[model samples]
Target chain A: MQIYRFEDKKPFMEKLEELLKSGFTSRQLEIYLPHPDHEIEELVEEYWPKSKLKFITLAGGLSGCSAGFAFTIFTSLDWPLITSGKPLVSIPPYIVIAFELTILFGALFSLGGFLLLSRLPSFKQIFHPEEYGNEFVIKILREET
Target chain B: MSHKDTGVVNQEVNAKSAAQVKDQMERDILAAIKKPKPVYWLGLLITITMTLIGAAAWAYQIKTGMGVAGIRNPVGWGVYITDFVFWVGIAHSGTLISAILFLFRARFRNRFNRSAEAMTVFAVMTAGLFPLIHLGRVWFFYWLFPYPTQRLLWVNFRSPLVWDVFAVSTYFTVSAIFWYIGLVPDIAILRRVRTGWQKLAYAFGSLGWKGTFKQWQHYNQIYKYLAALATPLVLSVHSVVSWDFAMGIIPGWHTTIFAPYFVAGAIFSGMAMVFTLVIPMRKFFRLEKYITVDDFEKAAKLLLFTGMIVGYAYIVEFCLAMYSGNPFERDQFIYRAVGDYAFTYWLMIACNVVTPLTLFVRKLRRNIKYLFIISFFVNIGMWLERFNIVVISLAHDFDPYAWGTYTPSIIEVAITVGSFGWFLTWFLLFSKTLPVLPITELKEEAE
Candidate 1:
């Protein structure tokens, strides 16, 4: 195993790009950053596809919208009592419910998707993991076979 | 030294400086979470005592009955409702800073977003308590939920109260998740730095965030989506709160403009509260380096902008009420200005409208001391604003015979004081426990 660390992002990006150009597959290499950097994200994505968290958010939002409307309409119909002489099913007010649920579920599902994709709450990593302090690190795990 | 040797030395010096900056950023930001001083304990002690007073007052109300509150036949909704609106309004600025400013790519947001979001969660928690307290029984609070019953009765979906239940609960959940997501990486940093139980706690809180490329890729995407999601959610939550009044046939309460008007006022008051909390917090935490005066100036601009909108809303409300050709509405507007609650009405105008105008002056905009003083005024003014809208309208409705005045009983006053205590207690604990500033975001900006 080989490790390279840089204190500055500029030199760090340069080194990563140079290594990539020297024919190291993105999969064979591991990277650590103190903070998220878009430039590094784009560079890594050139080898891998982008994150699929959006689909999860979309699914959560759509279902929430439907469930909101469905629950409100169903319950309204379930009792069939109309006060204020309004319609038994009021779309205007139900729209508010649907809208709120859309955001609530979208946010929640996005968190779950992120955790699943990132493999968070990993017991092994939580108790015992490699630690790096304020460095941009690159680890190459195998020789170029 | 030759030119080539000088160039090599310059590069070394630059690299060393960059490393020092990184170290300083971590040390400065994390320093807030260190062992507290006597002053910190004193503040906590005071807040906790206030919280108990509030709790004890609440217990008194529960035991004595709703009669202990000044809320009676005519002015049924009083200080409790005002507090609900005020606190919920307070939560708005957090969303405005963390989610809305984030979308706009306002760099100033980094300095205040963590605390603002914390305020959002805490304020909403405080706000959520009022409806139950107002419910009198408080035990039947679950009746607000839309569950089936033996008689097959269901909660009125059309009622704005039900909408409020959905809106506020959703706001609380989403705000919390957004806050925790932001904290994960920072907690990971703490996990590395601290030892013993603190390290274990942070490790659990961080969920083992290693700052890997894959983790960040997903983190960035979710954060963006959450921000996008939160912007509308924040607006809608306040709008729903407004609808609780707007849907009513009460003269002052019913207005088409209430949605935008309340939304703007929410942001305005919320911003002032941010200034109120953050100004002292910055001094106490010694975060002047990270949270600079320039950042406060930028946020002041937001407060100024929103304050103008709120002021405009006040004028528009009056003009529309007078021109509305409805005597009830017209009387409601007149009573707001010159009636029993007239003092509160003018105070709201002075604080919400006039005080913020100072920020238009460049000198005053940057003056943190002046901003802090004005923040207190705005907080009081906004609370009075809600009080005027809720109590004034209810105090004097259509029939002159039914009109009645309200003076909050001592119980109501104690509960109000207690609410502040409760909110401050949570905030003080948060400051000592969690990373008050978003260290990861600050590092990103520094880089």
Candidate 2:
């Protein structure tokens, strides 16, 4: 079994560089930390066909809001209504629609963000020797026995 | 030292201190959330009990009938409607503080954002409840929606009350969504920071967000877009609420001035509400450093500005009433000033006008105790402001025989108290569970 912690970029690269040069495959997993270089991720795909890897990325609030808004508005556009001799798509009335849509979207998006990132409804947390840290640790892992 | 040289040195020193104040301000905010409080969840308990009691009272009001409160021919909307306007008006400040300030690039909002955002959510929650509570048949409340039915019941499209259903519901939904969405990245941060149930909750809300470039790119784009969208809500929401009265045939309620008038008063009372909540929470949360004197001063400045507008509206209303030379309108204005409800009118003036006018002085703005005292009056004043608009208008019409008084029954008062409880409870729970401050948004602002 083997364990590697990705800290600074230089150390992480050096370790990966050694792995690439030495051709150490199998029974290993590189824990890809948050905001890991896309090229390195690409490299993993190119070089190691079956070697195990885990990835975690950091996301913020606005993204969640957008997603939620998009889901609600697009999904419910067909909702029927008539008022004020104005077009169903009038500006003044639509202002209300837009406001509600934006808010609903922002909320659901946040909830969605939490769900996607956190991997919730998760009851058991196993200390399976193979742990990855994206926040402070970046990458974490365990090698096969 | 030469006289000219002495003046120059003092000016330079003042400039140096001004620069120092900004730097100190930043460091102070950074220290605030980091310095933890004992995390007394008493607020959480109190708020819940209040919410449940509110719920029970609302349920009882519905089951018994609208008569459970003090609604009759003269006073159609007593506490419930007054509260609806009051709570909706209160909802204004959150968006004003968070969205308006952000658009204008005001850095002072950082300290109050979490509290303000939480305020928006709770205020809206409180507002949303009144509509249902006011609905004598709460069960059939959904009938207000323009849904196709076999019974062929369609909501009155011409009625401003129906417009209110659209405006208030939309405002609350969107604002709540905006508030929650802004909270996501912070939820992720909290997820990373804590363990056990806290971690679980944050993790759930964070939605597996990894804060990568693609995500941040999308997030920033969406946030900017949403901010743009939310800004107009500041105008539209209160205007729509005002339309509820404006569309009516009542002389005072039907005035064209209502839209702008209500919006101004909404903002005035809204700022006061924000002050009332922030003053206490800042102390309890030990957040004095972040929610600094500057933020309070700025808000007070806004409160005064709105107060002036409200005062202007008062003057204009009387002028309009007299100039129009309609005895009915003139009589209504007179009754409002010196009528049976005179005490409420005077209270409104004292809180919204005479008192907040003191805020023109910077010293009183920063005086926390004074802010709280004034804030209390502002609240009382703003509430009366709505009361006078709704009840007083109804009490005195063109016909003297219809003129009547409205006194809230015990149930009406209970429900109002319960709404406050509900609002506070939701807020307290939220503050503890979520990162009130949008750490990500603030980080962006700082940059």
Candidate 3:
């Protein structure tokens, strides 16, 4: 494994781009950043695919919307009692619940999705993980052929 | 010095400075968590003591009965309700700073977002308590949720109070998750720097973040998405809270404008609170280099902007009341200005309206000391604004016979004070335990 480290993002990105241009696939190169950088993220995205976390957020949001409405409607209809001379199934107020649930579930699922995608909470890594302080690192996993 | 050689030299110089700055950022932030001065302990002691007093008062109320609280008929909601709204309002600008400004790509947010998010989480936790405290039977709080009860009854879906349950709970959950997400990388840093038990604790807290490209890709996506989600969520929470009153048929409470008005006021009050907490924090932690006066000026501009919106709301409320020729609405507004709580009304106007106007002047807006002093007024004023809305409306309402005043009993006062203690205790602990500034976000500025 070839490990290249830089203290500056400019040099780091230049080195990363240089590797990408020299027939090094993203699969063979692992990048580590002390902080999330837009330029590096974009450069990585060029070789690697876009993150799939958005799908999880969308799915979670849709599910939450349906659940919110279904829960409110089903519960209201179960009793069949109405107050304030209003309709039995109130869509207006339920929309508020649905909207809130959309954000709530979307946020939570995004976090879960992030953890899952990132392979977080790894017991091994937690106890004994690789530590890099304030460096942009790119480790070449293997040379092609 | 040839041009090509000078360019190379500049690049080298820039790289060296960036490296130095990155190191400096980490060291400065980590140093804050290392030691506590006597004043830190003193502040902690006072807040803990206050929290205990508040808890003791709550215990007394639970034991003695709801009668111990001053809330009675005609004024079924008093300080407790005001506190609920106030604290919830206080939470808004945290999200505004952390989530909304983040979306706007306002870099200044980096200075305040971490502590602001912390404040958001803690404030919501504090606000969540008032509802349970307001409940005469606190144990039956579960009834607020739509659960499978033995009686087969569900909470009223049409009620604003029920909506409040969902809004506030979701606000709490989402803000908490967002806060934790922002902390993960910072926690990883702490885990690396600390020793023994501290490292172990931070290890668990960090969830074994490796700062890999893939991890950061997902992390950035979720952070952006959460900011988008929380922007609307924060606005909706206060609107839903406002509806708790607006949906009512009570003259003063029933108004369509309450939604936007309350939201603007929430942001306004929340901005003041950010100042309230952050100014002293910036001073104590000696974070002047990170949270600069320029950042304060930008935040002050936001404060001024929101304050004007709130002031417009105050005027528009009165104008609408008078224009409608509704005696109850007119009486409510008139009574608010000159009746039992007139002092609070004017105080709110002076604090929320007049105080913020001072910021329009460039010097005052840039003056951190002046901003800090007025934040107290805004905090008090915002609390009173909620008081005027909740109690004043219920006090006079439609009937002359029911016209009565409400004064918060000692128990209620103690609990109200205690809520501040509860919020501060968490914040004080947080300051010592966690990075008060987002170390990762600040590093982005180095490049």
Candidate 4:
């Protein structure tokens, strides 16, 4: 992993565009930044077009909605008690549970996706520059010829 | 080029230097976390003591039963429910500032969102305790959850209390996640700068973020989604809380207007709490440059807006009560204004409605002292507002035979003070331990 440091964003972005234009594969190069940069983000999107993050959140929401409804309905049926003489499968109050669960599961799953996709909890000793949080550093993983 | 044009271009160029802004932000924000002042420790000690008192009060209440806490036949909800709602209200400002304001691209929110979110997490923690305290058997609180039990009795899905169990818990989970997710980058920054134990702790918490573009991109996406998810919660949590009353048959509790009314009041109180916490926090941490007076002015304006909404809710509630020709609702509203609890009702009006009007004056809006004082009044007013709605309504409801006035016992008072102590303890500790300002967000805003 070869790391390059730039004092300003323009050169860093220029170098990023050069690498992308030079046909660097997504796996062969990675850009590290102190914060999100719009230009670099655009370049990354152009190079690596797909991100599975949103799907994770969507899947979690659907699962949560189903689980919320199932839990409420099953529990109500299990008890088999009449509440305010309302229907056994109450939708109005159940919607509250469904809404809460949707958010709860969506957030949890999004965090999970973040951890999984970002390859976090990396206890391995990887090359990380101290100024990575203070300055932009791009690392290029080149294959041996 | 003109001199002014050259000067403007130079300023823009200087601001575009990411290295300088990043370095300065790291130094400024990290300094608050690294340096431990004596006053912070003193504040922590005071809060710990108050928390212990609160714990002791709870222990006494537990041993003696719920009767010791001044909740009786008519006023069964009493101070515990009031504090619960008040703290929950206080929790809303964090989500409002962090999620809602972010969606709106409110730049000033960057300065204070971290602290406000932390406040939300802790305020919810404080609020969670009230239901347990209200429950006579705190140990059996799990019965609220719909677990497969031997008795086959599930929590009633039709009940607002059960909705509260889900709503408050979901709010807490989402708020904590949103707050922690926002802190990841900052935590990674801390891991870089700190030493030994602190570095190890931060490293573990930060999940080994390398500031890679991929990481930030994903982080940014998740943050947006989480913010969007939390926005509705800021409305729904309070609305569901309002339904805890609004769904009831009690005269004051049974009203359609309670949903939006409670939501507005929650934000109003929450904003006041932000001012209450941030004023001294910015001073104590010496973070004047980061949390500028401009931020305070913006927050004050938000306070004014929410306060007026709350004021409007109050007026509308009264008019609706009068116009409905429902003697029960009308009597409850009149009783609130003229009955035994009228002092509290009037005080609520003065604090929530009258005091915030001063913010309309530009000079007063910018005055930190005035803001602080008004915020304090607003906090008291919000608490009183909850009290007026909860206890007063119950105390004066139908069946004059069952109507009764109630007062909080010393134990309940102690617990209330302790809740504040517990909340402040977390805030003070957080100020010392983490970046009070979001360093990355601040850098982005600067750009």
lDDT against true structure, model 2: 0.66
DockQ of 4: 0.64
| lDDT of candidate 2 over B1-447, digit per residue (tens) | 122212322243345442233233333333344434545456666767776776787777777788878889877877888999999888888888778887897867766766787887778878877888877677888887766677644554445566577667666766766676677656665566556876776676765555532344345444454566567766777888888888778878778888889888887887887777778767765665445566677778888898999999988988998787788888888888899989998888887879988988877877889998988898898898899998999988878888788899888887888888888777666655665555554433322
TM-score of chain A of 4: 0.89
DockQ of candidate 2 is: 0.07
Task: State each model's C-alpha RMSD to the native.
Answer: 4.2, 9.3, 3.7, 2.9
Among incorrect, acceptable, medium and high, the docking class of model 2 is: incorrect
Proportion of the native interface contacts kept in model 2: 0.06
Interface RMSD of 3: 1.1
How far residue B379's Cα lies from its native spot in candidate 3, in Å, is: 0.3
lDDT tens per residue, model 1, B327-387: 9999999999999888889988898999889888988988899999999989998999999
**Which ranges in model 2 have alpha carbons more than 4 Å from their true place?**
A1-145, B1-42, B444-447
Worst 10 residues of 1 chain B by lDDT: B1-10
Give the residue spans of candidate 4 off by over 4 A.
A125-133, A143-145, B1-17
Two-chain DockQ for each candidate model: 0.78, 0.07, 0.81, 0.64
TM-score of chain B of 2: 0.89
Tell me how many clashing residue pairs each candidate has.
Answer: 0, 26, 0, 0
Candidate 2 chain B minimal-lDDT segment of 10 residues:
B1-10
Pairs clashing within candidate 4 = none
Per-residue lDDT tens digits of candidate 3, residues B1-447?
A: 122212322344465666666777788888888789999999999999999999999999999999999989889989999999999999999999999999999988998999889999999999999999999999989888888988999899899999999999999999999999999999999999888999999999999999999999999999999999999999999999999999999989999999999999999999999999999999988888778778888899999999999999999999999998898999899999999999989998999899899998988988899999989999999999999999999999998998889999999999998999999999999999999999888777556
Q: Give the TM-score of chain A, superposed on the true chain A, for all candidates in the order listed.
A: 0.90, 0.36, 0.92, 0.89
lDDT of 3 by residue, A73-145 (tens): 9998999997989999979989999999998899889989999999998888799979878888999999882
